[model samples]
Target chain A: EAGVAQSPRYKIIEKRQSVAFWCNPISGHATLYWYQQILGQGPKLLIQFQNNGVVDDSQLPKDRFSAERLKGVDSTLKIQPAKLEDSAVYLCASSLNFHGYTFGSGTRLTVV
Target chain B: ELKVEQNPLFLSMQEGKNYTIYCNYSTTSDRLYWYRQDPGKSLESLFVLLSNGAVKQEGRLMASLDTKARLSTLHITAAVHDLSATYFCAVDDSGAGSYQLTFGKGTKLSVIP
Candidate 1:
């Protein structure tokens, strides 16, 4: 089975600019998650999707960050007006009915 | 709210030594996972422990979960340089239903030769 796939392994954007990251989960998985990891800290959950429908986004900064998992297969996380603090690794992970999660390579974003 | 805490945020051990990393959670959860991550890399799952007293081992690393105490441990036996990486423990904070993981601040291990 293929692992979760992410695109644009790296990205650099100026503050207040917009950026998006893409992720393709493992085939047949029903749950997808987006996490943001800052330097020297643990990964924090940004959003969660259960087969296209959002299960949780409590931690997401709706004003700047938004995520969607369309068709219940692939997901995209976008950050508009990126802040310097937003410079971190954005990770995507998927699970089969909420078990055995596999993570993607992640997109390293640098907000200048 | 769910919170996970890992102790000794940094560990430096000599090769061929032994050490343990501890994870404590502040909620009721049965599913616990241990993941390893190298610099500039993604997380690699090492162990998934469900239920009380579940222990799993692979190579030089062993992981144990004690649900009664809301704690989990990753022990390194005869540590090797290859085992030097960040280790994280996550809990399915949704009580085994949603599987939304709440991760702990990772334990960074440096195995010196």
Candidate 2:
């Protein structure tokens, strides 16, 4: 009955620094997703995982962004050498077998 | 990548009125999802329409899908101020090798009293 959980509701980092956001999906959920929502824009898919195995990550910037959902339970999204454009709300969502997603209160990243 | 578009990006309406928000997708898909988000908050699942002519309603909000038209509609009946929020419609990327939701630029609705 619990919702998806994300940590560090807000974060601030300097340009070129590194940062990470954590997420814990709901129990028995098989799909996990990470999305980046820039101000006034739609949430863009960064990565998606189906039970620890990556189902899609084509939108992720491999040179800077990386994500992993280990053991099919929790996920973490990392951005290395963060840029000003990387300042956005990182949202984590979970779904049961490709159904509707339940999102977490995203981590707002502010890169200075 | 699938492209989703929602018309009337911003709407300001008076309470007790009626309105509809439209969502259009670029591809053919059978399932469409609608979500509502409040200011500084997470998305809340509103309706998951799985087929053509599928309609679901809760309280004053109603959603319908037309697979052939690649469109969905969110109709607000007797609108209330509590319905003020951003509404987004999404569809799964049916392209090869990817499975993620493609979201539309949301429709921010404000119901004035």
Candidate 3:
């Protein structure tokens, strides 16, 4: 089976600039998640979508980070006015139901 | 809030040796997962333990879960250089009314020749 697909493999942006990352989940997976992994740390959940409708996003910084999974297939995460601390790897994952998550290669963002 | 902790944040072991990584969570959850990640790469699922006392093994790695104690473990048997990677244990919090994973800081493993 094809793995989750992510774009831009890498990105560099200046502080206060805007950037977006895209992800295409595995075929037929109903749940998609976005996680932020800082250097030498675990991946933290940023947002979750269950077939287009948001399931959880309590950890997302609404003021700067926003994500949407339109049509319940592909997802896009955008960070506006990016901060230096926002420089991290953004990972996208999908599950058939609630388990067996498969993660994408991730987008490495370097905020200058 | 849920917290997951892994011991020995970093581990350096000689090849042909054995070691175990521990993961402890602050809350109750029956689902535990282990994932391996190489530098500059995505995570690869290694194991999924669903119930207390569940144990699963693949290749040179084995994982066990004890939900009663809110703990999980990944054991490396006869470690090899190819096993060098970051290992993470994540707990499913759906039982807590949220469908998300709470991950541990991860253990950076380096296998020395």
Candidate 4:
């Protein structure tokens, strides 16, 4: 079975520029999540989608970050006017239920 | 807001030593998950503890949960270099469904030869 897929593996963007990361979850997975993993810290959930409907997004920065899971299979996370603090690894994970979350390789975003 | 805390943020031990990492959460949860992550890599699921007194072991690692205390532990028996990695504990609230996970800061382990 294929695991969660994400691209590009790495991204470099200047401050004030916009960047986007894409994720394709495992087949038949019903839940998808986006997380930001800063250096030396655990991954923090930015948003969650359950079949194209948002389950939680309380931690996302509404003014700069946005995410959507169209058709409940693929998802996209976008950051506008990126800041230096936004540089981190963006991880996408999927699960059939509450167990066995499979994470993608993640996109390392560097905002200069 | 739910909070998860892991003890001994950094640990270094000689090979063959034994150690245990503790994870404590602030609220009741449906399940607790353990994940291992290497440097510059994504998370890999290790164990999922579903109920009180749940214990699961794989190789040299054992994970146990005490839901009544809202705590979990990952015990490493006869540690090896391959066990060196950041360990994270995450909690899923019962009513929050499957998407939200509250994660601890993580415990970084290093094994010496």
Give per-residue CA lDDT, model 1, range B1-113, as digits (tens): 89999988999999999989999999989899999999999999999998899999999999999998999999999998999999999998875356798999999999999
Q: For residues B4-96, what per-residue lDDT tens digits would candidate 3 score against the true structure? A: 999979999999999999999998889999999999998988999999999999999999999888889999999999999999999998864
> How much is the lDDT of residue B5 in candidate 1?
97
Alpha-carbon runs more than 4 Å astray in model 4:
B97-99
lDDT of 2 by residue, B54-96 (tens): 9999999999999898999999999999999999999976566
Candidates ranked by lDDT: 3, 1, 4, 2
Top-lDDT candidate index:
3
Quantify all predictions' global Cα lDDT against the true fold: 0.93, 0.91, 0.94, 0.92
Taking all chains together, each candidate's TM-score versus the true structure is: 0.98, 0.96, 0.98, 0.97
**Each model: TM-score of chain B?**
0.96, 0.96, 0.97, 0.95
lDDT of 2 by residue, A1-112 (tens): 9999999999999999999999999999998999999988789998889899988787899999988888999999999989999999999999896757889999999999
Model 4, range A50-86, lDDT digits (tens) per residue? 8999988989999999999999899999999899999
* Candidate 1 vs candidate 4, DockQ winner: 1
**lDDT, candidate 2, residue B26?**
89
Which candidate order results from sorting by DockQ in descending order? 3, 1, 2, 4
lDDT of 1 by residue, A55-75 (tens): 889899999999988899999
Give the lowest summed-lDDT range of ten residues in model 3 chain B: B93-102
Quality class of the docking in candidate 3, CAPRI style: high
TM-score of 4: 0.97
How many residue pairs clash (N, CA or C atoms closer than 3 angstroms) in each of the candidate models, in the order given? 0, 0, 0, 0
